[model samples]
Target: MKKAILVAIGFILYGAAMWYYLMHGAQADLPVQFRGSAADPTMFMNDRQLKLSYDFSRIKDWIYFLSVPLEWLIYLLVLGFGISKKMRSTVKEVTRFSVIHTALYVLLLSFLSWILTFPLRYYSYTISRDYHISVQPFKGWMKDSLIDFWVGWIFTVLTVLVIYFFIRKSKKKWWLYAWLISIPFTIFMYFIQPVVIDPLYNKFYPLKDQVLKEKILTLAERADIPASNVYEVNMSEKTNSLNAYVNGIGSNLRIVLWDTTLDKLNDKQVLFVMAHEMGHYVMKHLYQNLIGAIILSFFGLFLGSRIYSWAISKWGKRWGIKGLSDIAGLPVLLLIFSLLSFVAGPVENAVSRKAEKDADRYAIEMTKNPDSAVGAFQQLTISGLSEVNPPKLVKFFLYGHPTMLERITFLDSYKHKYEPKELEKAKKQQR
Candidate 1:
């Protein structure tokens, strides 16, 4: 009994220490930067200033060169860790071991990304082409690739260096800086991105249809969201998949729609989906999300600081990662993110699920066409092969929203509630 009590106490202390480290130590090191916005030429990506052009082949090369090793390393670690279960290690022992292993992996990855960022210019572009998703030429591709690499490198190095210094000066407050950095970084990335990043990936055409523009503005007014602008991004230039997102904030706001979404779905379905996106805007989910992210990232970094920093400095020499930009170390970082993902994953999913459920409710109420909403839900299910059944714990830990089955079930219940009135009303209205 005493031993069990001690174990419980130890875990409690560890949790508090983890919280303290993350909340106070590492927040300022990472910040939210990229986001979607209407009218912003860079709505889709930081293509222009970042120098992105569609060239999936080049992206494939970069990933092949840089991200692949990390991907494989993570795969192996998962397998190794699972296999070690037969050794019957206690959870605490595993936790400590995993923490060390994950931290070293993350350190290596950070250094590798710094090194391979230049190649990222070509990297993302190639991904576009190789996937048959790109409509960009090589010249545009090369230019964009370089921009992506350099800008990405600058932003990354600056933020990382800042956090590293803070970690050095005050291990206890590393998480505070992590939270603080997200505010400025999110704003800068949001505004400059229209100019710096998106032009390289796809063309931005102003909403040419005055009538459609007027309708969108009207919709925004009805939704109580201001009309920053509206745009039809040439997503067809890159891919035919449909999507829509309400981008930017305040003056930077806009309803950016992909042509594919326009082409595929009818107006009602589009409005239903747009309403969901608008739900995010009205709820200010993005900002809330930023805050949450800042908090979580700090947690991750605080837990990881000593482990990763030590590992990087020590093993860095062996892998030829003399600088933070060493491309070879990316896998290590991924391994860390993969490992720490267990905790943050649940927190993130909880927030997202709340937001998503709220939006689903809003869409149902606004459209007043629960049937259409149901159809849309079906579309999502079949389109994705989303599992209908998942363990409750899995939903808690991994799911960002209620399972699709639950969503469908809710809508079905809704349908049953008004079936008689709905049927009679439909018949009367038709007459």
Candidate 2:
């Protein structure tokens, strides 16, 4: 009877999630506004700017598209074939202790999942290399991949143990307790990732060019960002793409630039990029996202609890899951989370796009260099093979940052100080 009540609550929460998003998160569908003449020659990219010969092949696009569904399919297979239960039993036989069995299952499940998913991963890398986006040698990439696998394994063990503990202790309210715990865990992971986890793959050092570093430090200071030193990572060894980011919290905080970005972008472009990254910190986007995640996790976990109960009720006997506490149900939990994430993409992207837009505006205002912002985005477009105008579906579902065209157009429309009369005139012109 209690299970039935939970299931009904899940359905209610799911409906509420949908309605909440419709009321609050559906603003992303609003039409884009263009100022100035549509026929303005500067609005379109020239041949060199567009990189006419760039090999952003349709095959690569299809591969990316297909891989999304393929990933969900793989997750489904983990549960559908009874592999999750069989592996759980095997680990149980090896160790009768719940804690040891959970640890063993985490390792076994990670290894099996990695093995099953490696082909798609290899193909994805092959495509990146084929398109000249990745410059890392296969052996080097594989070594990094191995490191990444073990790192993921460690985290999985920690998470699965906590979750099962909650399930065993409070079967009905575990989701609530787990969600509460995850808030701090998420923040800790974010805070530590730049310092601890990221260094495992790429080497980082202080920016070598003292002049450039000072310039970046000056910009950071001007932005009131607490970062004193600038760091550069050996990203050229991995990819030809350009990027810079401000990461970590408190003493661990610093601005990191990719060596590739330094090699390719001029000083002004690099400054603008740094400023954009600093904008994120100044705007407190990290804290905002954390708060948002905590809120959403409440709804998501509640809904997931309902779905989980229903799934286990239908498949529990066949899959050998005794209840939520059963180790065999790990895959089911993972699948539920994955599905919820997939469904929540648009709402998440809407929030991300707003943050990115705010950062762009802050960077422009701080640097007082609209042209540099435009040039920086153009460079990103060419180097990253970013689609300037993606399909509507892709834009709505997948895009976290606005398209290069939209960003450049915004820069083009920048006005330092438009009088009320001029603003009215501009609005008329746009109409």
The TM-score leader among the candidates is: 2
Prediction-by-prediction clash tally: 57, 0
Specify the poorest-scoring 10-residue window by lDDT in model 2.
34-43
Query: Residue by residue across 259-360, what tens digits does model 1's lDDT show?
Result: 766666666666777777888888888678766766677677666654555655876555444433332343344456556866577778978988988887
**Native-to-model Cα distance after best TM-score fit, residue 183 in candidate 2, in Å:** 2.2
Candidate 2 residue 431 Cα shift, in angstroms, is: 41
CA RMSD of all predictions = 16.1, 8.8
Report clash pairs, candidate 2: none
Report the lDDT of model 1 for residue 284: 86
Q: Best candidate, lDDT-wise?
A: 2
Q: What local lDDT score does residue 192 receive in model 1, on the 0 to 100 scale? A: 56
> What's the residue-level lDDT of 175 in candidate 2?
90
Model 1 score (lDDT): 0.56
